[model samples]
Target: MSQKRNIFEEVSDEARDEQAVQPGMIDRGRGGARKAIRAWLMVLFGLVVAMIVVGGLTRLTDSGLSITEWRPVTGALPPMSEAEWQSEFDKYKQIDQWRIQNQWMDLADFKEIYWWEWGHRQLGRLIGVVWALGFFGFMAARKIPTGWTGRLFLLGALGGAQGAIGWWMVASGVTQGEGMTSVASYRLATHLGLAFVILGFIAWYAYMLGRDERDLMQARRAKEAKLFSLSTGLMHFAFLQIIIGAFVAGIDAGRSYTDWPLIGGQLLPPDMSVLDPWWRNLFESPGLVQFIHRCAGYLLFAFGVVVWLRGRQSAHPQTRFAFNAVFAALSLQVVLGITTVVYAAPWHIAIAHQLLAVILWALILRARFLSAYPVATSVRG
Candidate 1:
């Protein structure tokens, strides 16, 4: 027995020596690719932020539905000639917005709105191309895990679905009577809500796969996961708020509630009973939609405050981060919502307000991810 070495143990040792793989094998090549991915993801996130802001602009400027058709493959190629421009306009002419509402509008005016919708579509298209190319490049270069490669692919697929949803949303207005100029409230909300969902998911997934949380302490990880879950819960609330907000925007609801802490100087707003039996009015009445959005804002801010107060004791940088990020963003968003109500939403201010929500949300997600995993550290004797 003393002269014998176990064959299995011998083989294991030989394999270890030959392969030279370490305990940190997963982290190998993760460094460069992770950095690259972070940089690229930051850019993608910025573009999404830009697209959202531009979308707000398109809405405020009343430029949506300018193009009037879904030409996914050919749409990528813009109007190149006068004839093509007229052809596109002719198609738009068939729609209710053009034929009934904007029939008197001239070509130059059409161009003004057309450019906005075109910019929106083109930006979305660019996001798709960049994400796909960067993802594939990283995979081929042996930078990211095959698992992540699959996830990124699915995200790209989501981008594709979003395009279809955008058209579906636009097609709603087209289906309405000849004088209607805007998409259905529900469709509008769906397109906007879905965009935020996809953006949030991408940001969260990036934080999960690419971020290294080794800087955090062990106790913090357990605590942060709970907080992260809470933060995620708040995000769900925020989304509902967005849909309510979209209903307001769709019906020009916020435009009328030009006062804070009250609606038209009243507690419950006058005439909230628009849809007969009262229940349906929440979605149908602009007053009710704005009112509900305001209530949701209060709830969201309150949740953030509670998460921060309860979790401040966790001995983790990210625990503090999780609480603070959500609190700060929630506070700011609440304020912005009020101002948008009071000031009637100046374009630049409104756009900035929306963009900050996205920024704070992504950071809050970072906090969540770090709290869950913490950072790996070596034991020191």
Candidate 2:
């Protein structure tokens, strides 16, 4: 329909229609269901944290080798009958852990440890399902943001690898004639290290997705590069510490030295040259491993302080707050580490310490993210 136009008419229907049809961020292929994906990731994050804690409990209770088999699918279901329970217990009796340490465990006692390992595996399976559903759901709906499909897929791939690695770690202890009571410390380190890596990726992705792309792009211009670098270094250092901690847990090294500031009241534990191959001492010697963990903890705390000071100098209030949180967590983690050692790494205290590690890891990652993509704030008080 034609409309009467005034002499000063400045716009046309075609022009208005064009303007209305103009693409936005979503139409431009720059966006997705960001908040939805973030929520999904947060769910995965919590599950992964639970997995870590449960894994810790499994190790603490010496229950990691209970299942004795890696049935990714069939393993999801625990024994339903007494016969099935005895069958599972029979497999446990074949392992070195069962022979030397848990020889006294009857069918009833076997069930106790079996449940812990089963719960740990079950949590892992749950995390995988959550990731798969979220990833595939977003993929099928074509809602994943540009350049994010590969990233999301990587998480799932690593998760699969983690399952295989879990089996590998368990297999190390399910040996004959080696007298192995636990998994190889190195394998444990690798498994735990990968978990932290997955966690870091999830956290970083969520942080980026929390804000609008345009805002993130703009924030990139004002990034505190030096602070970001420092935080990056701190993050890597902390990850190394976590891997070493896994070593400590693998061998129950924390119980070797109950005193702080000294090992057996000396600068080093007695008989550092105990292991025959010399290299074996690094992994097999509890005294040496715990010593390394404690020293690394001190160094990590010192470095964390340095990074925090630099973060405090940032102009952005949000960035400063994030770093402050990191420092607080770092301080608390150190104290917890000391207490865990003092208490001989009791399951409760040790799990708390491990839980704090997860918290600290996330906080450090958050601080690093802010340093890289700072949130803008007003100058006015």
Candidate 3:
């Protein structure tokens, strides 16, 4: 004998089945942690740009060797007292840069350059601290996204190496005796090149994190192979130009030849092989260095135009616009480069040129990322 069921109560097998399975289903909540980490990275990105600009200023002012010592911790605290300032000045005096180049710099003058280098170093320390706190905080809470722990760690590692390289660059000028007023051109290029590398990583990471993981995975299906390859070549070419530009700055080559579209009133300057070894002239010869920089600039612009033309053919409007920006920046940068040469690379113009390079670098990365992950738009767009 079975009990009679109440007719007023609903008996739905589908509803029961749904309720039973709901608890076992995975919960993919909104990406709150991912967004938070991305925001932190953006902050780090800004700081890195600031670091680059400040470094350029420090070099332009010839203040990179003012400290003469690497005191990562103690050096953060600037000399506050008169005696401390004197001690700092004395240390700088022992360096060859002081004896040969800055012999005229008194204590008061020394203080000015000292502050520039000090500030540059202090900013670097600040960046490291920020990265450490953000990274560890995310890690401790287990908020770091899957497959991102190693990438985040790489940033800190590169930053640490940059600091050591900075010291090495400064040491080059200090240790070299007469006729050496600045750091080695090659070492300076290494230091600057690393800075740009770190910048590129932060930029690419930020861009990837801007979209949802699934969306990015889906977009990868529509990747533009040709555009990505072109942009990759453009990136490498731009980087080579940057290193060459560093060599120019290292030897004050910009001021040596103040003519554009011509070097020393000709396509090639007179003393290209003046240095003993032919290779040494490439790095040490102002005319040859500047000439290489100029030639690279022309080639970069031509290649950029080619990339932009291909990028214009992209079906996505946003991708097309991204490449358009790259072209615009490349054009402006070319103008600035020529102007920089015409005016002998004044501090202001030179710094602007360097900063523009940073902008162009980021733009190229953006275009490249878009090519790899084309953003879908409406047909009308």
Best model number under lDDT: 2
- lDDT string for model 2 (1-381, tens) is 987889798897887898885545543675889999999999999999999999999998988999988899988999999999999999888878888988888888988999999999999999999999999999999999988999999999999999999999999999877999889888999999999999999999999999878888889999999999999999999999999899899888999889978889999888576999998888779999998899999999999999999999999999999999999999999999999999998999999999999999999999999998998888774
Q: What are the per-residue Cα lDDT tens digits for candidate 3 across 55-75? A: 999999999989888999998
User: What is the Cα-based lDDT of residue 331 in candidate 3?
Assistant: 99
**Model 3 TM-score, 2 decimals:** 0.93
Candidate 2 has a TM-score of: 0.94
Could you tell me the lDDT of residue 26 within candidate 2? 41
Indicate which candidate wins on TM-score: 2
My TM-score estimates for the predictions, one after another, are: 0.86, 0.94, 0.93
Model 3 clashing residue pairs (backbone)? none
Query: lDDT of model 3 at residue 236?
Result: 96
lDDT of model number 1: 0.76
Q: What Cα-based lDDT does every candidate model obtain? A: 0.76, 0.92, 0.91
lDDT of 2: 0.92
What's the CA error at residue 215 for candidate 1, in Å?
8.5
Count clashing pairs, candidate 3: 0
Better of 1 and 2 by lDDT: 2
